[model samples]
Target: MSARKVGMMTEDELIHVIRAAVREEFSAAGMRVDAPADVDEARRDFMFLRRLRGWVDGTASKIGGAIILAVVSGIVWLIVVGAQAFFNKP
Candidate 1:
């Protein structure tokens, strides 16, 4: 294997190399890798917002579903108990 000296690289070159390596790693993990020029500040901000919105939507739906289920079960139990009491009257 050939060896290169890290100290010989300029700061910018070292940074670029590290960035490329990290990008490759994420790409290998099946993520869509956008070119650096394609991802401006606006794109980054939108990505963050989109992810946050998705999280909030998923959590809210789960909570709402649980609340609906509890309310329905409570209503059913009350109806059943009221019917039994009325029928069992002496």
Candidate 2:
């Protein structure tokens, strides 16, 4: 089919052209076009997984920070006690 300029196309023709272009792109990318219901289900699954990953990453970062802080505090306490003992030696 000959291509018509967008300005020359009716609404229906524009819509049809747009849909055909989209389908061609999808096929070229090796992607399957799903039905509406399947698309909705896939979207839900993707969102859930994304949220779960974010939560796990945040929790891990917080736990790691807490552990590092505790280790540093312990080292500081030991240094303070050692310094006091060294200065008080008779």
Candidate 3:
């Protein structure tokens, strides 16, 4: 195609020119430019469910870690108290 001033091109013509240039650049770089696949309702729903499950799993792990930390801290406190009482005995 002959080079033309961008200012002379209409909106559609500009888009077409840009797309052609991009495709050429991608092909030169050995990259494939495939159109995106259409996502149907079922696929969208499944994606949302997957995201929700991931969030729930992350939150559950955080809660489990906090519970474990609290249990460990309680055990440490008991050990410290017992040691102090034994050391202060008559």
Q: lDDT: which candidate is best?
A: 2
| Segments in model 3 whose C-alpha atoms lie over 4 Å from true places | 1-39
TM-scores, each model vs. reference: 0.50, 0.60, 0.55
> For model 2, how does the per-residue alpha-carbon lDDT over 1-90 read when each residue is reduced to its tens digit?
679644677989989889889867876876445577755765787799999999999999999999999999999999999999999999
lDDT of 1 by residue, 1-90 (tens): 359554688889989988888777767865545766544754786799999999999999999999999999999999999999999999
Worst 10 residues of 3 by lDDT: 34-43
Candidate number with greatest TM-score: 2
lDDT score at residue 66, model 1, on the 0-100 scale: 100
Model 2: which ten-residue window has the lowest total lDDT?
Answer: 30-39
Predict model 2's lDDT versus the native: 0.84
Clashes of each: 0, 0, 0
Could you tell me how far off, in angstroms, the CA of residue 15 lies in candidate 3 after the best superposition? 40
The TM-score, computed over Cα atoms with residue i paired to residue i, of candidate 3 is 0.55
Clashes of 1: 0
User: Between candidates 2 and 3, which one is better according to TM-score?
Assistant: 2
Ranking by TM-score: 2, 3, 1
